[model samples]
Target: MQRLAGNLRTIDPEASESLRIVSYFDVLISRGASVDALLRGAAVMASAVVGATVRGRTIRRDADGRTPREETPTTSSRIDGGEWTAWIERPGVPAPLDDVILERLALGIALIESRRRLPGGVEVIIDAGMGEAERVAVLARMRIDPGALVRVIASPAGALSGADDAVILPTRRALVRVRLDRELVPPQKPGPWGLGTVVRADRAPESLETALIALRLTDERDRVVDASELGSFLLLARAFDPDHPPADVVALSALDERSRHVLRALAEAESMRSASAALGMHHSSVQARHEALTQTLGYDPRTPLGRARYVAAALLMRLAES
Candidate 1:
């Protein structure tokens, strides 16, 4: 294909380059290249900066395969692929093959995205809507033992660094990663991540649900939430109504961002001095703030019962926001 493209470039550059574009993307799709690889390939092929937003995750690469500094493109050609988009950045006039490259890139991305969401694919394997028989069939196709243990990790779209062998599915709300329980490792990056309970391969749907719930419960202090550790708190999270939140949740929502931060610190800290240290405020200041919070929240958050109520309200507040 490269020889054909090089030879035909002498006679018809545009036609030859269009053929190259098609052939290049064909190889990528055949090999099941990742979205980042596709972007890099397009950038190198066009000898310009290429970018894409796939399922709300944005990525870019320059011709040298490094992320380009953020700047406005002087000239560009963009193509929309429903939930995604692809584009090339060039200076002055657009490259002759820019349009073809984007079209192929977009098409390749759509195919890969669709393939990952199809039946017997990553998405379906963790889809709670799928029946047990269907999930079992998917597990069989993926060569995973039905009784083998697995866990799901859920995070904001594009948050997790996926392993080559891991099954990653991008949903509307979160990125889902399914890995064998034994292979599970700490997340490679900082995240408000959710770790689901370990369960059989055929029961991944349940894991996904808890993973998402755990994700919703995460805050700045608690970046990773483990569903298995939540105990009865998970039940409370499910029973809480977003439309009609409890009085504490309402009070929490009414507070300013700074006040909310102080409240969270106080609720999670063991003592007033600890909360003050966490907030980087003097003990006197934290004590004064705590007194004001007690008046505002109608409870002393330092007490055990008050801490539980505050924590529950804070978690439920996140669910309401989600």
Candidate 2:
């Protein structure tokens, strides 16, 4: 566990003690711990947390603050998107806590987050320890299709509570996600003040951070904003320096409302056609406007880094005014 934690810390300096405890489970499970052993071990672990709030969405830890299978819902799931949750039964042997005590079976806490509420099912966890056949067998019992799962933490971890693309499920506690949708997108609603970003799922952590950063910058309460679509203010924000006037932002300030609309559309959508659809304008006009905006800004919003800089500038512009 110490060696693994060291390696994990080398990857991300901020990896917490909680992450380490979970990593220990991940490591042991990976070491060929049997399904029965995994099940028994988790039940025994739960006995150690007796009377702790390790029971719900709260972070689970012992009195000494030792973190165990710590799972936060959005803290684990609501990352950059694409997760399907099942409301199912506990993933272990069906002995209730009382039943376990009556039967003299030590009920341990499995590493699943005690707090992530999967409203319809008893909470369960699938240890990363299980083999492909074992995993398939377990999922079959749970009535989940094996083909639909996505591995979380497949991408590198990002900042913000050490957010990664790890799936937070009841029994399928393995770092795998069930694809509810192809795109792990947040709710998409466009507004003059909204923001959105087009990100690779493999880069979910940073993508989540990018969206969250834009969310922090904007003040829109009713609309679900994506960072990419927040318009000139978000663009100007990237270029704005505290000690200097945002000289680059001046380029966008002179643009007409229709042009701004085109840029915002361009920021949110993939291409000229999509931008036109978003703006409810003619594609030729949108293409023309996008080209003009590219020339005017001295960069294309169609590229990833370019779009990021554009949104950054836009966010700073909002900050300057607010």
Candidate 3:
């Protein structure tokens, strides 16, 4: 068995490379090698390759039947450490692991995280702005719903809001944001999920506050699991920004004397249209402003925190002199 395994390792035939990697592992397991060790080795190699490729390292080939590694200028200089080369040199490489194929795996993880963090009406913000082809590629890599990514953009106020609120464009540079309902539904426990919250520093002026103070929520997902927990996870994630205070804390700070008045009018609004009329704008304009308020206030019906924003904005506006 040892001799056979040895022979398998020496053979470099393309047809046998995959078979060798698989059979090698089987033999190692039968010989009492730890399976976790094998897996860790594979993961280490995979991470290295991805880190290197993302940094632009390429394998150089010459007529000597040996391929040396070289890096291209086009490769971003941000590649991680040298551990990846160590993986290739390890006793046996795993089947799914490739010396040069790191992007696929890293992208898979990123895409998975993107889905895990899905926000209502949220989409993945690619490192480079995404296009149809890019979106298709991302979905394929992540194995997610095709419609998962939709176009979004920042508002004139520099808040990361959806473009559908104001102007229309075929392609635009934007950050991803998700919106939730105005009430909180109890979320199921023990689910595949995560939550995050963002808050802005209060001392800064309005323009800076708008730029920095945006709230986002997402569910850190693993395969299909409980719907309720997933929803709750997203709720918490949006509300769990480490840098800023809780959504409620920052939101209160966001509404100064005048903005508080506007929010009050908004909360009292029967519908977005009614809110518009009360704010003294066209219904269409009010809807845009309302949408902006919703983004600013981080109101989602699925969670208690969101409800507070919904209520506070309205109650505050009513106190203002008409």
Candidate 4:
């Protein structure tokens, strides 16, 4: 169809004769040539290129190109008896060829691989410089659970502890004191990193501590911050069961080091997703294990009260074990 200069793979001299004539006419017009004179010259050129017998008529431009009028034979013309018409259209507007093609290629790749990956199971975190609203929009597009995703600093305090009371400020500045554990972070390729999901407080125990410390530091620095810091701290402590351990409440005959290790991982992780990823297991598996542990340890891991008891038991057991 449509005639585009970029799409011109081959040029036909005979077919393009009209185009050349039009270009010449345009140049003449730009140099202060009369419109009527240019039109007459174009007509003469068209006639000579094909034949004098062929009547040169200009039709309005169509969606494809300039459509020519049907020719009528003139009596005193030195031309072959055949219908020949000239078509011309504008020549310089360029389309977005590369962008369209690249987008199509990306869509094709995504379609092919979409079926192979797990169903919305992958976690991705983008670091600072990503504004909150923009980050939310991106995560929403990726189908990631916002509650499960962690956004923090590159330092130790940026990570989350099990404390739900730890606060996150609204400022756009980067943090310096906290760092998330690298183990729970997604792999990043070396490049100009604008954004991606990396380490968070949910990554490890040390990571969680970093988050808490960061919050504490921020709190000590200023008092005008929102409830984010305090809420984070409280939630984190409940999640980690800092004051309760399984050993403190559960009899020594009931649990082992492996079970405690799993519990500690849960307590340390900021979210269940992080905990599951850390353990290299499905979330369901972790939940099932916690359920069984709860039955044996006489407490539920999902409940805040149960977590508190578990922490106490754990601390007491650690003392006894030592």
The prediction achieving the highest TM-score against the true structure is 1
Supply every candidate's count of residue pairs whose N, Cα or C atoms clash at under 3 angstroms: 0, 40, 28, 56
Candidate 2 regions exceeding 4 Å error are 1-216, 221-243
Deviation of model 3 at 29, angstroms: 85
Write one digit per residue (lDDT tens) for candidate 2, span 217-271: 5455423355555555544444444345455566666677777667877987977
Those runs of model 3 whose alpha carbons end farther than 4 Å from true positions after fitting are: 1-245, 300-305, 312-322
TM-score of each model, in listed order: 0.57, 0.29, 0.20, 0.23
User: Worst ten-residue run, lDDT, model 2?
Assistant: 76-85
Clashing pairs in 1: none
> Residues 33-130, candidate 3, lDDT per residue (tens digit)?
22122322233333322122211333322111112254323322122333222123222333344633233233332333344334312122222112
**lDDT of predicted model 4:** 0.37
Error of 3 at 100 (Å): 74
Give stretches of model 4 more than 4 Å off.
Answer: 1-248
- Tens-digit per-residue lDDT, 2-118, candidate 4: 263224435654334434434444443333222122222333333311111112322222211112343433312221223322222223332223222223222322332344233
